[model samples]
Target: MRELRILVATAEAERLRGVLVMAAAQVALGGQATVFLQLDAVGLLRPPIEAPRDGAHQAAGLPSLAMVIDEALGSGVAILACQSGLALCGMSAEDLPAGVEVGGPIGFLQQTDDDARLLFA
Candidate 1:
């Protein structure tokens, strides 16, 4: 199975939720998946995650964004927060959730196989 490499560069809740869902789905299908969080997207991972549409999702019987993130992490989806993104957000590595990794784009790309599917959101 081809790997999925997703670049989550936005702070938008809906987009982030979609990216997480895709990554989680990829892993559930037995493919490797990585989500690289950069720019303002890094701020979304901080504890007590607040998404404006979280309530709507729950009301519609879908998992909230926070729940989706936790599900992605639990399902072997690799999540990397760019080091510079952390600095940009004034967040330290310790500020991220336990399963998230801290690294840069170059490192994230280097780990991707030639056959990996790359996505930007």
Candidate 2:
């Protein structure tokens, strides 16, 4: 299976949810998946994990963004937060959950395999 590399640069609720769902799907299929949260997106991972539209999702009988993130992590989906993004959001590595990694864009890109499908959200 091919690797799925997703670059999440926005804090938009809908888009971030999509990225997480996609990453989880990829992992369920026995593929490797990594989600790189950059820019404003890094703030979403901060404790309390405020994902906008979470209530709407719950109303629609869908899993909330936080639940999706947990499922993804439990399923072995790798999630990275950009070091600069954390600083930009006034956050530190300790602000994020245990499974999320802290790194830069260059390092994230360097880890991508030739056959990986890269996406930006």
TM-scores for all predictions: 0.96, 0.95
Q: How accurate is candidate 1 locally (lDDT)?
A: 0.90
Q: Which regions of candidate 1 deviate over 4 angstroms?
A: none
Clashes counted in candidate 2 amount to: 0
The numbered model that scores best in lDDT is: 1
Candidate 1: TM-score?
0.96
Model 2 over residues 1-121: C-alpha lDDT tens digits?
8899999988886887898888999989989999999988898887887677889889999998888888889999999999989999999998888798999999998999789999988
Where does the lowest 10-residue lDDT sum fall in candidate 2? 45-54
Which ranges of candidate 2 are over 4 A from the true structure?
A: none
**Index of the highest-TM-score prediction:** 1
Error of 2 at 32 (Å): 0.5
- Model 2: per-residue Cα lDDT at residue 81: 94
